[model samples]
Target: MIVPVILSGGSGSRLWPVSREHYPKQFLNLHKDDASLLQEAARRLDSLDNVAAPTVVCNETHRFMVAEQLHQVGVEHARIILEPCGRNTAPALALAALAACQASASARLLVMPADHVIKDEAAFARAVMQGQALVERGRLVTFGITPYTAHTGYGYIKRGEALGEDGFNVDAFVEKPDAERARAYLENGDYLWNSGIFLLDAKGYLEALAEYAPDILEACDSAYKAREEDADFVRVDDERFARCRSESIDYAVMEHTRSAAVVPVDPGWSDIGAWDALYELKAADDTTSGNALHGDVMLHATRNSLIHSESRLVAAVGVEDLVIVETDDAVLVADRRCAQGTKHIVNELKASGRRECQSHQQVYRPWGHYRTMVLTDSFQVKEIVVKPGAQLSLQMHHHRAEHWVVVEGTAEVTQGEGHGNTGDMKSFLLSEDQSTYIPLGTVHRLKNPGVIPLRLIEVQTGTYLGEDDIVRYSDDYGRG
Candidate 1:
């Protein structure tokens, strides 16, 4: 059996504004569809023979988003593994191999990153079949994309002696080459772009890892053995998982292993690492210009430019080779040639302590979302939406008082000292034009009793209206 391990733990900083630290590009519908990149990745393996439900390894912070996205795609029971901290691809794969080995002793693991895009599913499946055959013969396999150009953004893999019809022994792994060397590599038809997809048997991988990356293997072994299974997630022990030395699979094992092999894949695969790459994938006019995600854009006489606006209409006049991104709090305009340096801007924001670099004005929660509409010294206003049957934590704020005016649907409001009691909990069914007030230190909880989304405008008056002022007494979603 082949157990597909999907790694979805990247903070896509290059595509900022649209992709923030809390919410990255993998979760967004970059192709302007309901399905995200991660969802598409999970769906791609559905037709493969002997494929088990995907085992997802993601960061702990993105656990809710991962769960919600998978649930949206009708995946009810996938093995969702949570990484306490990222130790790069090697340890992540080691943990996944350990899990698959525990479930089935002879399982073959097909590891793929969740953020990639493969346009041709049939070609990808055929490549996977070749990879599976190689893995069954005890070969550590990696997919190498047939390079289309002298692109310096990605590393290249050199092919060695041919092992089969569609497989070759990996000659060497080369780092990102300079422009001249990249051009030379493209000219010589023996190199392929390192696509970072791999296939190997569970026990074979563990043995190869023990030989090449013993420290990583040992750390992962201890972490997996010490893991505690929650309701639906497998939580690796924090101390052991953190002790794993951070490294990629290329550096730790694939490069050093004698059994390494490569399979050529030319299925329109793209990592989508930068704005320029996204522009290349998008539909373009004669001017080679496109709009970024979630923007009202109008371009005239523009060529090779990407304009994105979130809050207002953005018009570009006579601009060429530019990237313009606008969010609620910040806007960025840069040359398309230097789009890779956008990470420097994120680093500067981190050094100077700016919230705009981290998240947006609207924050997503498992229940719903709350957007900060207005803020002031003595008061703050927010628009909150609660999904049907969803409830906020039973909590109280020490330094703030709140007034809620329901605009749509019905809200079940509980107030006063007897917050959780059966008889003392007075349920006030609030509808349109109805409102309620809760004084400071009063234990209150809000719930959407109706089948529709509950929308409300919240006005707060307090000495301190920060989010940390709340003391959660009880929560339904296991949040402390």
Candidate 2:
């Protein structure tokens, strides 16, 4: 049986502001549909036959989001493995393969990144089916995208001999070439864009790793052996996994393996590495001058650009070849030609310790989300939304006091007398327009009991208003 391994470790810094470190592009609705890229990737498995539950490898900080998105898509019993720190594709796949082998000895992994886009599900299904026999026979299979253009952005794969009917033996794995070389490869008709999607026998790949990169294999084996299960999360040993060298699967295994094979297909794939990539999604149909937009956006004579407005109306006039992205707290304006250079901007922001690079103004938690409304040294105000039947941790702040004003639905406030410890819990119901206050160092818990969502305005006054000021004594989402 085939088990999809969804690698979702990328920060997607080129798509920053819209895609932050805390909430990356994989979870965002880049396709302008209700489902995110990760959800779509999971849902795409519905097209494949005899596929078992997928294994998702992601950052530890993004565990809740990954679980929530998969749950939204009804992908239950899926393994969500948490990487304490990114050791790149090689280690990520090793953990996933080990888990798959433990579950079923005859498992084959269909490894794909969570952030990839495929327009034709049928084409993808056909491509995967084409490599089934090859993978079953212990051949490491990779899906090579049919190159339609001389694009210098991606690496190329050269095919050698025909492997059965669906694939060819991988002649060589080449790096991203310059414009002249990319054109040469594109015109050669024997090359394909090296799409990172792969298919391999779980045990077979592990054996190949043990031979090729034994240090990565042993480090991952030690970590996976010491891995612990916590609810939906599989926690790998951090220190051991950290010692594993960071490298891509291409550099670590595929390039060195003699059994590497490629299946060429076109499913309208794009990694969505930058804003221009999103714009190009529709430019082919509109004579290379279409404006791809999301949210509330208006354009007058804007050509070959992308305008994404998250919270407000963004109106652009007479703009050509530009990328305009607007969110609640930040806006990005860039030339479409140089949109990939946003990585440099993100690096600068990280060096300067900017919150915009890490998270959005609206932050997601296990319960729901909170948007920072107003913040200062002495006081901070936030708009908090709790999902129905969800609640905050029963905890207290050491340096801050909070006042919650209910704006929608209902809240059950559990107030404690003193610090964050066992005490007489005084409970009260707060309806719309009702207000409550909890004194400094007082333990408090907020729960949504209504059928609808609970929305409230939280005003806090304190010496330290940072998120770390609160100590979580008890949390339903298992923070404790």
Candidate 3:
């Protein structure tokens, strides 16, 4: 049997604004579909015969988002492993391999990143079948992409003698080459772009890791053994995990293993690392113009440009090879060639302490989302949408008090003390235009009691209105 392991821990700083530290491009509906890249990656593996439910490894901050997205696609029984701190792909895969081995002794693990786009699922599955046969024989396999262009953004793999009818032994792994060297590699026709996907049996991988990176293997083993299961998440021991050095699997194992092999796959694959790559994947018009994402847009004589708008209409005239992205808090306009440099801009923003570099004005919560509409010294206003039957945490703030006015549907407000409240509580029903005040230190909670989405205008007033001021008394979402 094969078990899919998804690594979803990238910050994707290169695709900033839409991709933030709090929410990255992997979770974004970049294809303008309901399913995110992570969802698509997991769902595509469902058709494979004898494939078990995927095990996801991600940063602690993304655990809830990953779980919620998988649940939306009707994917249950997925094991979510949380990393206390990222130790790169080597430790990430080690943790996943350990988990898979515990679940099934002889499981073949297919490791994939959550942020990649594979346009041809059929071709990908066929390649996986070929790799699986080799993996079962204890060969460490890596999928290499047939280069469609002499691109310098990715590393290349040189193929050695053909191992069989399916694949070839890896000759060498090359770093990103210059344009001239990349052209020569394309001309030679034996080099393939390193796709970073790997397939290997759990036990075989552990053995190879122990040989090549014994420190990483030992750290992962200790962390996994000391892990604690909380709800649906497996929290790794931070102290042990922190001792694990950060390194990629390519450098830590694949490059050093004698059993490394490369399987060529021709699927239309892109890391989607930058806006220009996203532009290339879009369906262009006769003039090579495409709008990749949602929001109102108008273009005239715009060719080879990618524009995304989140809140307002963007009109472009005679713009060529440009990227225009608009969000509620920030806007990014750059030449297509400079798309990779957006990471530098994100760094500058971080150094300057800009919030736009970290998250959008609207933030997602377990229950739903809340957007700040206005803010001032004494008061703050927010527009909140609560999913049907969802509830916020039962908490209180020492620095601020909030007034909630229901705009649509009904809300069941637990005021002071009630049956649902752990301590002294009062209950009240609020309808459209009805308002209630949650005084400072007064434990309260908001619940959507209606069938439709519950919208409310929350006005907070106090000396401080930061998000961390809340002291959670009880939470249905298991957040403390």
Candidate 4:
């Protein structure tokens, strides 16, 4: 059996505004309307045979989103490993390998990132099959993309002696190069872009890790041994996993392993590292004006540019080789050539302690999502939606009182005092146009007890209206 391990722990700061700390690029439907990049990655395996359910490794905070998205795509039996802190791909892959070997001793693991775009699924499958064939011989296979341009965005892989028709011994792994070096590598025709996708025998990978990076192997082993299962999530020991030094697969294992092999392929792949990649991707599909526009956008003489508007109309008069993205809360404008520099802007926002750097006006929870409609020093207003059969935690605020007005469906409201005692609670149903008030320090829970979604307007008044003001006495989702 082949186990697909999807690594999805990137912050994707370069694609901010749309991609935040809480909702990253993997969970976004950038190329497709209904399927996200992660979904596309998971669905890609549907073409291959003998593949088991995927094991997803993501940040702990993103566990709900990952599960929800996978469920949306009819993937229910996935094992989601939650990392308290990212220790990079080496440790992430180690966890997956350990889990895979535990399930089936002969299982091979196909590891891929969640946020990559591969247009040619057939070619990708062919490459993966080639790697799988090589894996049978105990080869640590890395898929190398056949480079067509002098792309400085990706590292280069030098091919050594040919293993077969489509496989080669990995001669060297080169870091991201200058434009000159990149061009040389492209012209030389002996180099391929390091695609970061790998196929390995589960037990063989663990042995390689033990030989090449024993400390990482040991740390991950201890963490995996101490793992606990919560619903669909497998959570490792936080402290032990955090002790594993952060390192990429290239640095910790592949670079040191003599069994490294490469399978060069051209699968129309993109990491979608920055806004420019999106432009390039869309521009490929439409070549009339070299402009890739999304949402409510009107462009005039905007050649070779990308303009995306999420909530409102964006008009560009005269822009060339530019990228403009407008969301509900923020807008990004940059030269397409310098789109990679957007990470520095994210760093600046972080240094300034800006909330926009972490999240948007809308926040997602296990129950549903809430969008801040208005915010101020003394009060705030939000529009919240609860999925059918979903409920919020039995929670209370230390410094704030809340007023909720039901706008759609029905709401089951529970309000109480004194140590969150349900026996002392007053529970009632509020239909459309009805309202309820929750005073400060009152234990309250909201549930959508109808067949449809429940929509409500929430007004909060307080001296401190920060999200941390809430104390969750009991939670349906295992939140602290």
Best candidate, TM-score-wise?
4
Q: RMSD (Cα, Å) of candidate 2?
A: 1.4
lDDT of 2 by residue, 1-480 (tens): 999999999998999889999999999999748899999999999999999999999999999999999999899998999999998999999999999999899899999999989999999999999888788666899999999988878899999999879899999999989989999999999999988999999999999999899999999999999998987899999999999999899999999999899999999899898888888885665664587878898777878888889999999999988889999988999999899899999999999998989989999999999999999999999999999999999888889889999999999999987766458889999999999998888888999998899999999999999998777778987786
lDDT for each residue of candidate 1 in 1-480, tens digit (9 for 90 to 100): 899999998877888877788888899777547689999888888757789888999998788888889988888778889999988999999989999988899998899999888888888999999998888788999999999989988999999999878699999999999999999999999999999899988898899899988999999999999998877788999999999999999999988988999999898888888777776666353333454434688878777777778789888889888888887878888898788788889888889998767788888888888999999988999999999999998888888899999999899998765333323555688999899998888888899988999999999999999888878888887778
Rank by TM-score, highest first: 4, 2, 3, 1
TM-score of each: 0.95, 0.97, 0.96, 0.98
Clashing pairs in 3: 416-425, 416-426, 417-424, 417-425, 417-426, 418-425
Worst 10 residues of 2 by lDDT: 282-291
Residue pairs clashing, model 4 = none
Best by lDDT: 4
Better of 1 and 2 by TM-score: 2
Q: What is the lDDT of residue 330 in candidate 3?
A: 85
User: Where does model 3 exceed 4 Å of error?
Assistant: 283-294, 417-422
Clashes of 1: 0
| lDDT score for residue 201 of model 3 | 89
Sort all candidates by lDDT, best to worst.
Answer: 4, 2, 3, 1
Tens digits of per-residue lDDT for model 4 on 1-480? 999999999999999878899888898999888899999999999888889999999999999999999999999799999999999999999999999989999989999999999999999989988998788878999999999889999999999999977599999999999999999999999999999999999999899889989999999999999999988899999999999999999999899999999999999999998898888788876688898888999888779998889999999998798989999999999999999998998999999999888988889999999999999999999999999999999888889999999999999999996644555888899999999988888889999989999999999999999999878888989887
